[model samples]
Target: MYEDFGEILINGGNRGLGLGFVKQLLSQAPQKIFATYRSAETAKELLELATNNPRVLIPILADSTCEEDVSNVAKMVSQETNKLDLVINCVGYLHNAEHGPEKSLRQINANQLLESAKMNALPTLLLAKYFQKLLKHDQPSVFSAISA
Candidate 1:
């Protein structure tokens, strides 16, 4: 499917499944791919890919949970490419070093719940809101999200 990918955006592409998607997409020979990461320190592999494939792979530092950041990323992309062929929201947070899912009803915390929702649920809407301008309204422009 990515054989014809002109310009693609993959949110949270620093690690895990997102990382896999980035690698696989590269193998599929996409024209240009924008991969977002929250920190450079944790994005060594992604950075390496960006460095090796300078003309095709671009690693962007962005926090998907932040609306302003998302908007800024879209602006940056607009500077490079006027249209986006695909957008895949791979952002999700079920657990981290400081927290994990509640094993029981009593273990849930307000902050954790909000954090999960912000990362997992809001990215698709926010990306769409800010990047719709970069999409081709008259042609095939795909927007998608992955959940587990």
Candidate 2:
């Protein structure tokens, strides 16, 4: 699918499946790669992996729930690449510790559900909205998310 390469933007590429995608994409020799991470510190490993690779770039910070963050990423991507071939929204989180996942139907509070929806769903919607211009006429401009 990536045979004729162009820039690809990956949100939440700090680790796990996102990181794997970045690593494999790097091997494809795309024109450029823009990966986002919530915490720069958490992305050190990935940063190091792409340290000497000129084709990789990490410009967006991971805050998919924030409109400002998403907008800024879109702008940055537009400035860096003429077109986006693929956009992979890999931002997600399972409630942790004090706010772990709601197990029972009765335990599903408004706050928990809202938080999950924001983390799991909203970003993709926002990304499509903000990046619509950049995706124009680009056939197979993929937008994907990994959900549990």
Candidate 3:
């Protein structure tokens, strides 16, 4: 399926399964792979990949949870390409230094829950809102949100 794609976008492509996808898809001959990373400090590997394959990989600094960033990313992508063949949203928030899996109902903090929702759910909505235009095509295109 990926062989048919000329352009693709991968959110949270700095590490984990997102990074794995980036590595695997490099062999698929896509013209461009727009990969979003949260920060340079955490995105060294992704940056190196972009540097090594400048023509194929683009490392965009963005926070998927931020609507403004998501909007800006779509605008930036629009400037480069008229259409995206595939969009793989791999961003997710499970736990951090301040929060972990709630062991019981009493442990569920409202603020933590909101934070989780912001990262886990809001990005997909914002991506669809801002990038729906880019995904439209006579051929097949996809906007996939993978929650993990």
Q: Roughly what TM-score does model 1 have, to 2 decimal places? A: 0.90
lDDT of 2 by residue, 19-84 (tens): 888888888888888888888788987788767675465546758889888998888887777778
Output the better candidate (1/2) by lDDT: 1
Q: Per-residue CA lDDT of candidate 1, range 1-148, in tens?
A: 6776778999989888889989999999888999999999989999999999998998889988889999899988988898998988888867888887789989889988888788788888899899988886666988888975
- Rank the candidate models, highest lDDT first: 3, 1, 2
TM-score of each candidate structure, all chains considered together: 0.90, 0.89, 0.94
Leading candidate by lDDT: 3
Cα lDDT over the full model 3: 0.91
Report every candidate's CA lDDT: 0.88, 0.80, 0.91
Across 29-136, the per-residue lDDT of candidate 3 in tens digits comes to: 889999999999989999999999987999899999998999999999998999999888999967889888888999999999998999989989998998889899
Model 1: weakest 10-residue lDDT segment is: 132-141
Model 1, stretches more than 4 Å misplaced? none
